[model samples]
Target: MLISHFLHGPVSAYPRDYVDGAHQELHQHREAQLLYAVCGTMRVVTAQGAWVIPPTRAVWIPPLVEHEIFMSGEVRMRSLFIAAELSPPSLQQCCVLAVTPLLRELILRAVQGPQHAENPLIQSLMLEEIAGLENLPLHIPMPEDRRLQGICLALLRTPDHPNTLEDWAQQVGASSRTLARLFQQQLKMNFNAWRQQLRLMEALPRLLAGESVQSVARDLGYGSARAFSAMFRRLLGENPREYLNALNKLSELNPLL
Candidate 1:
């Protein structure tokens, strides 16, 4: 017998608080969850994709979707869980959505409603807000090559280490050309592109944790924050401060920090 818990109406919104430079894990629930980050930065990984959910956006996790979330710095987040039937089919797929000002305010107001009494207006607003979510294409593809995976795991373990593809190739017992080819074949990106993506991914958590851009740059093997910022802008189309601000906003609404 499968016992089910019925969550009638909208679930209450609560804040998720965290300290600087910390990380945690969360398991999937039977119901879908809407996360809004009000402050700080967060990275979420699922079987389908991995997202660096900055403050200007939110992530929708459909019911029964197993996922893991990591926090980079002190985070202020809020979350709401809605019944699966109330969720749109598009949202049933896990993906990151850009949070507009209207949606942000709507979520804040819905969460601010009275705790005891069910607010029909809030429910309606919540549904409207969900309908307005714009799907985004920002995602990191997980590599499948064992050699590439080993290299990536090593870099993740020590993001500050300055190692060129030649060095990585030697460690993996392959030529630089072979590693480059493997990157394109397995990750659909060239060696430099894959490495830059990894560095950018690593930088999100550090920047959100309130680390200075200079500090983060040094940790990521860049000589200067300006250089790092340039690459970040080239890839993400935003400066570090703007990116962090967006991430902080998402953390404010994130239920799981």
Candidate 2:
């Protein structure tokens, strides 16, 4: 069902808390949305892909894009709804955005349900921040082809599996080259790139839940913690330990963040 509410202006904020394991069934909104998790993590699934949003990140979804949300833990969700007409070309597609300090404060202020006259400046700043923010590499695009879909689903179920594209090709009745071409043509990425995204998606919640880096690395099929840390740093600009430490430190220092 569609879960929408009337917005009083071009931008408005909705803040709500969720319990652990909460699930929002498939729904759509009349306006575009920025879903932010202030303290915990969330998994957002859209028709195009899935994104794991930690406290430091948020997802931008275009108006009327069917999606569902799964809360990873006790979550404080702060969301902003923008009038569909105000959505920019850059944000027309569903993607994840890195929430900076300025943006975080803006969201908190907006969530106070500010009056219309006083909202013009805040709305402009929020929109500008969102438009200028770069998309994070937190998305896992889903391929439309049934064969590729099967492979993607299986990998999600057993992300630690060491099956290569060639191995999957043997099992799926397609040549390795064909599988490679399908991934590129349909997912806009190679097999390895897609798998890397999948691994990152799997790692975020585990790390947030206090799993050891070494254990997470081993469970996710990495040869060692060092190798996993290298990959994490290359993609997210921080090693797993550093990333988790920063998040924990921030959480201790500020509740709004």
Candidate 3:
């Protein structure tokens, strides 16, 4: 069902906690949402795609886009709901974004106060900061085709499924060529590429849970830690350890985010 948040002001901040595996049913609100978290991971699914948001990220959801949230682990979310009229034209779609240190503090301050009403300076600064956030490539597009949807859902449920496109095609009662064509037509990517994106998206939560690279790689069906590291570097442009180090550095500077 859709939740109508009749905002008395331009921006609203909400903070909530979800234990691991908790689910927020498919729902929407009238306000554009900037869904952030101070800790844990958020898996946000909508009609268009799925977003695997780590602690350092957030999702910008346009008004009335039906969506659901699945907490990967114990999560504390600090979400901002902006009145649709106050939202900029650029943030009219749902996408994951990299949350900066300053923006995180502003969000926290807003959360520490009222849910919607806020000091004018804080509201203006928050809106300006939101409009400037750079989008991250953390979204995994879901296909519209029923056949492809089945395969995608299965993969999402088990990201470590060690199967090729040929194998999945056979399991889904379609030929390899047909599967490839549908992926291209709908997701605009090949099977391996899409699977890689999914794996990387799922990687962060496990890594944050203190799992070693070797353990995560084995569970994710990678041949070895080296192979997984290589793929991770290629896709994210940084090694897993390095990425975690940077995140740690940020946390040290601002524990609020």
Candidate 4:
């Protein structure tokens, strides 16, 4: 059944809390959901795609979209459900958002302190703040083909599995070229590119949890910190420290962050 009341009903606030490694069954809301992670990592997966939401960001799930959430480590989650009619046309689809400090505070209050978004002053600011948030490109698109699914699932389980496409092809009983073609057709990216993105997404939560660059590198199967930094810098245009420091900066405003 579709959950339609949160948006159409008078109850606009939805607050939820989850422990480490918590998993929620598939469900859809009538109203769009702003899923914020106050302390840990959240992985939101839908039929359309999969998103890795770190501390400094959140994901917007449009109304009536079946989805499930998996938490990494301990997680403090807060969400707001807006009326479907009130949701922006651009926000009708799910997206990952880079949460601003102001938006973060509004979400916190909406779920924790009081319903500040109910107040006229705060409501306007909250909507404006959300509109201004830049869309983050943090989603991993999955392929539906069983052959590709095996490869993707394996990498998803252990991102540092160190399996080349040739290696994966042998295990899956497909030619290396067929696997490569499947990667392109399903994921819209080659195997190596997809793996790089997977490693990056996996590394974010670990780094945000206070792991050192060297350790994260070792865990991700990089030869050294420099190698990891080069890849991160190349892909994200910033080193690991820059990304981790941004999270630290966000925590200054809201301690839960």
Off by over 4 Å in 4: 1-11, 112-115, 173-177
Q: Sum up the clashes in candidate 2.
A: 0
Q: Which regions of candidate 3 are displaced past 4 Å?
A: 4-7, 115-117, 252-257
- Residue-level lDDT of model 2, residues 1-257, one tens digit each, is 77875466788788899999999899999899999888789999988889989876789989999999999988989888888999988887888898877887888888877673138888898888998887888999999988899999999999988998999998889999999999999999999989989999999998999889999999999999999899899888999888888877655644853
Which regions of candidate 2 deviate over 4 angstroms?
A: 116-118, 253-257
lDDT by residue (192-218, candidate 1, tens digit) is 776677788778766765689999899
lDDT of 3 by residue, 103-167 (tens): 88888888886642477888998888888988877879999999899999999899999888999
Which residue pairs clash in candidate 4? 3-30, 4-30
The sequence of per-residue lDDT tens digits that candidate 4 reaches over residues 37-66 is: 776799999996788888768898987899
TM-score, each model? 0.72, 0.95, 0.89, 0.85
Which of the two, 3 or 4, has more TM-score? 3
* RMSD for each of the candidates: 4.7, 1.6, 2.3, 2.8
Model 3 misses residue 229 by how many Å? 1.9
Q: What lDDT is reached at residue 15 by model 2?
A: 83
